[model samples]
Target: MAVEIDTSAFTEEAYELLSELEDSLLELEERPTDIELISRVFRAMHTIKGSGAMFGFDEVAKFTHEVETVFDMARSGTLPVTKALIDLTLAARDQIRSILDASRGGPPADQDNANRIISGLRALAPQKGGAAATETKAAAAPKADAEGPHVYRVRFEPKPEIFSSGTNPLLLLNELRDMGQCRVVAITNTLPSLEELDPERCYTHWEIFLTTTQGENAIRDVFIFVEDDCTLNVRLLTREEEQEDAEPKKLGEILLERGDINEEALGKALTPLGDRLVNAGVVSADKVRAALTEQRVVQEQKQQQTKAAEVDAVVRVPSTKLDKLVNLVGELVTVQARLNQISGRLNNQHLQLVAEEIERLTGELRDNTMSIRMLAIGSTFNKFKRLVRDLSTELGKQMELTTAGADTELDKTVIDQLNDPLVHIIRNSIDHGIEKPEVRKAIGKPLVGQIHLSAVHSGTSVLIQVKDDGKGLDAQLLRRKAVEKGLLSPDAVLTDQEAFMLIFGAGFSTAEKITNVSGRGVGMDVVRKSIESLRGTIDVQSELGKGTTITLKLPLTLAIIEGLLVGVNHDYFVLPLAAVEECVELSPKDIANSHGRRIVNVRGEIVPFIRIRERFAMDGERPIIEQIVIANVDGRRVGFGVDTVVGQHQTVIKNLGGSFQYSDEFSGATILGDGTVALLLDLARMVRYVEMQETKETGGA
Candidate 1:
């Protein structure tokens, strides 16, 4: 029976390789002489081609093979790394992605585009019989051999079940032989008799002696896919050993290097080593033969050496599986909460102890599960490099993207949703924030503008900023535009910070004319909505001449959050624990002293307050003594007045459907211990909404 292949796995790996290929190709254009980058590009394409063929992505394999051949020529210095080459290769990478996408029921890739790229590459390739052709032939010679060919001893001990995975060891051996002059010896010590042998299982391993100039990485690339299922050791036989005085390693040394014998065992053995060890039950005949074969091969090359070993075990898991796991964990958290409520009601010591233990484990599990979903934001950052490069070229501007703290991790869900908003920000920076090269020179600024994209951890939040040093947001111009668009009154007086925020207002643009990229006035508003939907906030800081900086403050995860549960009359609400500062009592006398103003004095600081019950329009009389939950909104201190403080709760956020989705005051809702639903407060948006209401009440102050 034939084994069925999972084409989706192949497509996924191909897509990732294609992405890395694009990044490598772009970097190659910057450092044309960097051999490592070239090798990386070649490896990515080679892996895609090899895996594509294996998974029957015939068209992908065929197209990639052509691109790979061209890159191979470049790798060997037969072709120079040119901007034209990078362009063609990038186009080819896109075509490969399109092909993979087509396989997933998307639009078919354009065959004409693929052919054009191939033709362009062939045109760049060195032709036969000219000076360039002769130069190419000379360059094609083994580069490593220039320093003298190196010999290596390789041992491949494949897992017995390799055959079940559709791997053919013979093909791997052939690939090794193709690289250089190689000798292979198969060991059958573990093979059973016919009656006990399993045809589907691999029983044999092999030893290989090879003299090659492809370098170690290329050798390892041959075994890349099977590395996880086999014991592979490749050791260099130093060139000095080839000298007249150098000798092959001793039998004991060979055995030790093969891990078949230890130094102590060898020291205890007598002469005629192999026969002595076998007779003494220290070695088997098969092991002795394998060692002798290695000894003979080394004699031809006259060298021996050893290398240390390191292994990393990795298993690729589908993101869907992780999502299911998180969902199950959320359910478990809910169940654990129910148990805690029961234990509290029963007042049973043993039951309370059990509930406490379960609660601790559940919290740990939730953290671990969320950690699994936390991916480095760098992958998202790398993609923007291409966007910046393309936009700079398209708009005739000179700008570069510099990034920091890319290793900052966020939940995969948030990261995925974050891409569009980031793209919009970067595009705006390129089109509006960065100046054209000539314009910059005229203004005495650097010809190439800089867009600094950085992220850093702040408490339980990640702060991502896109800053640009160009003609910054003109606060006066923004104010005037806001007035003209009726977003602000002519008599309105605003600080520079407030004026800068006018850009996020819908249909607000300072551009004199519209362009394909940004002037339609749709991006920043969408950005604000997207960030807020993730329970995040966006801030703007800019100067007249220097530049503009947009900062996004987002939570570490959206799945589950530590929330401060508070009660307003009969209903409960949760404020993100990270945002909650302190809670205090608000007596009716304090309210009377304030003359009905929604503000409280904490210490010497006057804090503005929001009455949750009034804001949500809940019908209930005010409590004689209300509790005030002081929280940080943006950078200001604010208080949320509620009936009581219900303590901290680990909230598994559940999206509010139907009409609740339209409410800006609550980001989401969670189930309480007693099965009641508690709405999560969107403090930033809530503050803005209340302030806007007050502004209207005060006649556009």
Candidate 2:
């Protein structure tokens, strides 16, 4: 029977490889002499070409071959990694993507564009010592450091049920042959008789002798996906041959190592007294031979350890699967919480004990599951390099992008949604924020401008900043723009922070003239909306002559958060623990001392505060002394007055649906152990609203 192969999977993988290929090409342009980067580009292209052909993407294979050929020249030091080469390769990468899309029955790509890129790639070859070449030939061929090909002896045996799982072992062997020289010998030790044979079962295995320059890792990669389904033993034949004088250990030493015989028995077995005993019919030769055979098997297995040790155990599990696992764990956590509540009410010691253990286990499971969904933000950060390059050229502004703290991790869902808002900010930086080269030079600044992007963990949230050392936001101009656009009252008084935030309002623009990058006033508003949709807040800071920095505070994960639960009259609200500082009592006398003011003095620092019952207009009597949760709201300390503190809760956030979409009071909600739904407060928006209301009241007065 013939098994069908899926070509779509190959195309998907090819797309990812092409993306990495472009990233590598861009990096190579910056560090043109990085051989490792060059090799990375080569390998990605190589895999795409090979896999493309196998999966019947002949056109893709052929097109990638042309790109791979240029990189081959790079690897050989014949062609240098010049700016021209990088640009051409980037164009080729795009062309390949287009071709892939066309292959999937999408719109056909322009042959003229593909041909032009191919022509440019071909042009790079003839300039060995010309304009494109930068380094000497000796410097190009760094791969020569690889000593030589290492010989390996590999034994592979598939279990009888291997065929049941639809694996073709021969295909694996063929892949091995593609790496280097190889030999195969079939072993049929367990072959059944013809009449009793089960045709569906795999009965034969093979001993493969392989020699490859790719090293043990490459060899092991062939069996990575199917390793557990088969028994694989790979050993370095060269090492064994070099250590030809490895002496055979005595049977007694082998028995001792295996914990079969103790020191007394081993000492007796080694001496002539043991031999005399065996000859005098006190011991059997068969027992001695069996121990020696066991020793030999252990010796052979030990020799195989070096090759096996190099392989890293990693599996690429799909994100959807991880999400499903998290969902199930979340449900379990809910159930465990309910159990704990029930056990407490019933006062059953045994049930309580069981529930406590489940609670501990559930916490660990929830943590591990969340970790799986956490990916470093660097990949998302690296993508902006291309954006910076292309946009800078388009705007004719000489700007360079520098990044730090790329390894900061956030939830995968957060990262995915973050890309668009980030792109908009970078675009704004390039178009509106950055000054032109001549203008920068006229102001005693360097002709080239700088845009910096960075991310860092702040409590339970990640802070990403996009800063530009170009033209700063003019507060006077922004305030004027606000009035002109009818976004604010003509004579309204605004603070610096309030003026800067007006940039996020709809139809807000400060451009002197409209341009393609961002003149129409839609991108900034959309950026805020998108960030806010992720339960994040963005703050803008600028100095007239200095620069502008936009900081985004987003939760680490949307699925689960560390929260401090608090209660009002009959309603409960959860504040992100990352934002919560400490709790203090707000006595009636403290309120009386403040008169009508909402600000409270904490340790000699006056901090503005919001009373939850008053803010929400809840019908409830005020407590004589209320617990005030002091949290940093957008970098400033603010107190949230609550009736009582409910300690910490592992809040698995649930959306409040479209009904509460426009609400500024609560971001989302979570279920409690007692089957109550508690709303999760959006502190940043809540605080902003409270301040806005105060401003309106003061203005009215």
Candidate 3:
């Protein structure tokens, strides 16, 4: 039976098989002598070669044959899977991919490189097998079939474009002859006359006869590539039958003659036998399901593992889907807000009951949708291992990366934007923060440096910190650099915190020398910008000669916020509830004793304070008996005086666009139930700014 080959499908299948082979090779890197891994690699290449010839990918077949022979030597224990061999094979695998990729249009592969790789591969082949004996066996193996040796007759007719596919039929015929007792007869009955012939089109077919102990399935395997495009019939023929000049039994004929199954039932069963076999474990259940699901897919194609193909499959869906879902829930929340407003306005029993029920359901729905986009930050953090390992090796430093709270989950969007900033901080710690081994030894420190990346939930925010047990930032050097860069006045008095913040200023790197990794004077500033863009804040704390720690505090999600709404001069402003420690009622005596300075005594600690009306530039007069909202930012307590506390609200955050981009006090805007827009306060930035002002005044005194 002549089977027509589809070159495109053949190439695709070859690539997939080779990819699996490469994966196996990679896995074997750690355990080179793993017999199972070696066998798998061999099987993968064998299948590629077998199917390649069947589909007219003769170049692939010929190339892979030599590679497989080398592995065979290793399989037989005549050669070991050395590190050099693995490296060479890895290179060869990459070359194979290049050949497959270039098959469509690129020039012929570099035979010199191919020959070189093959030579390396061949170096591993056993020399114990004398050349004369090997050649004698190779020549005589095809003629030795007798007795009950399995015989298979395969007829293949490739597509008319086979010739242009860079495949020669003679190569496949020769390959089959090398396998076992084989005879190939080309059939040109369909060829056009010389006057009408089109040379580009394939006008030849082949009927192949093979006798071997190799199973009937193995013979059919030779035709796997062209099975769909051509007709194929494989059966058993005994040596006695061949000598008696009897034709090979067709599959249907054997089934009928053997009385194993009836013709009518066999016809029906053949269609579903593959599915039944797959269900019974002869084939994978996934394959059976895929075939049942996609009827148009060929049986040979479906026979391959579905999971293998799907392993790398990814589908890109539009973000509009997520946005629409979020918007609908947002609207529902607004409606619930209106209901709550109505329930409060009218104490009607029925209305209040309905409002309570709707509120419960709406809250649950919002949480569920938000949870859908939450992902653990560990995946983003794990890539640093490779980075740290490479840098430590290059710099001749011993370093270990310790991560904690890897299960800490945050909004996917937040984590996505956080990757680059985190990389910068990690690189800084590895390149500049971590001291060299010799320096550390001189300082009585351990030879190895320790870099820790940790994340944890702090109220409604996620705090990620990178700390290293190495030389910390030099505050004095930072201050000197600040003055030199004209970032600070020459005689400016500075606190430790103020000096540390200078690293975040653009072009303010303190590294004495520049290397490929750091000291470019651009990293920390970028980290600051990225964190701030997410409505987050970063703090740097370092102990000289000990280590430096950079912490980024970010919201749990960007979409909604839990805020403490406060009244400032009849205007409502919301502060993130995560930052609020407690609220206090300011007494007249307490207000009078402050002496116009924004500092309040809470317990035994003196906490800095900021008047809300002054900070937000509100116009109305201040109210008596002011309410104070105490917030903690970067381990410092700061108090904000408001007219009244309006209680907590789940506010949906809205971006304040370009107009309010520079407004450090308000992070965003949110809509109230009464259709009023309240600006959301960025408590961290507000507290920092107030503390800076306070530091300047104290320094002046």
Per-prediction count of colliding residue pairs? Answer: 0, 0, 6
Scored against the true structure, residue 358 in model 1 reaches a CA lDDT of: 99
lDDT of 3 by residue, 1-701 (tens): 98765577667667767666665775676588775677678777778888878877787788787777666656544568887777677667767777777878876677788888877766555453543333333333222232324545555668788666566667767756645556565656567899999988887766566655445655665556655555565545343333233333344444355343455654654445655443444333433332232232222122322444465474433456876787788778877888899898998999999999999999999999899778888777766765686688788888988899999999988998999999899988988888889999998999999999999998789999999998888888988888888888887888998798888899888777888888879998999989988988888899998999999998899887688988886578998888889998777788788887667788877777788888767798777688888998767788889999999998888779898868877878888888888898877778767767877878842
Between 2 and 3, whose TM-score is larger?
Answer: 2
Residue range 1-701, candidate 2, lDDT tens digits: 98888776788778878878878888788899775687689778878889988988787787777777777667655677898888888887888888889887889988899788877777677555522342233234333224334566577879888887889999999988865556676766467899989998998877676665456766788898889889988876454334434665566664455344467655554356446435645344444444455445435544554454444245656778988898888788878878988999999999999999999999999999898899999989888999999998888889899999989999999999999999989999888888998998889998989999999998778899999997888888898998888887888878888899888888899887888788789888899989988988888999876789999988889998889999999999999898889998888788888898887879888877888999889988988889999998777899999999989888888889888868867888989888899999988889878777777888741
Count clashing pairs, candidate 1.
0
Error of 1 at 311 (Å): 8.5
In terms of lDDT, model 3 sits at 0.73
Please state the error at residue 619 of candidate 2 in Å. Answer: 3.7
Ranking by TM-score: 1, 2, 3
Worst 10 residues of 2 by lDDT: 130-139
* TM-score per model over all chains: 0.78, 0.72, 0.59
The stretch of ten residues in a row with the least summed lDDT in candidate 3 is 293-302
Model 1 TM-score is 0.78
Q: lDDT per prediction? A: 0.85, 0.80, 0.73
lDDT by residue for model 1 (67-94), tens:
7777777767678899998989998999
- Candidate 3 Cα errors over 4 Å, as ranges: 1-320, 393-396, 437-448, 603-605, 692-701
Model 2 RMSD to the real structure?
15.7
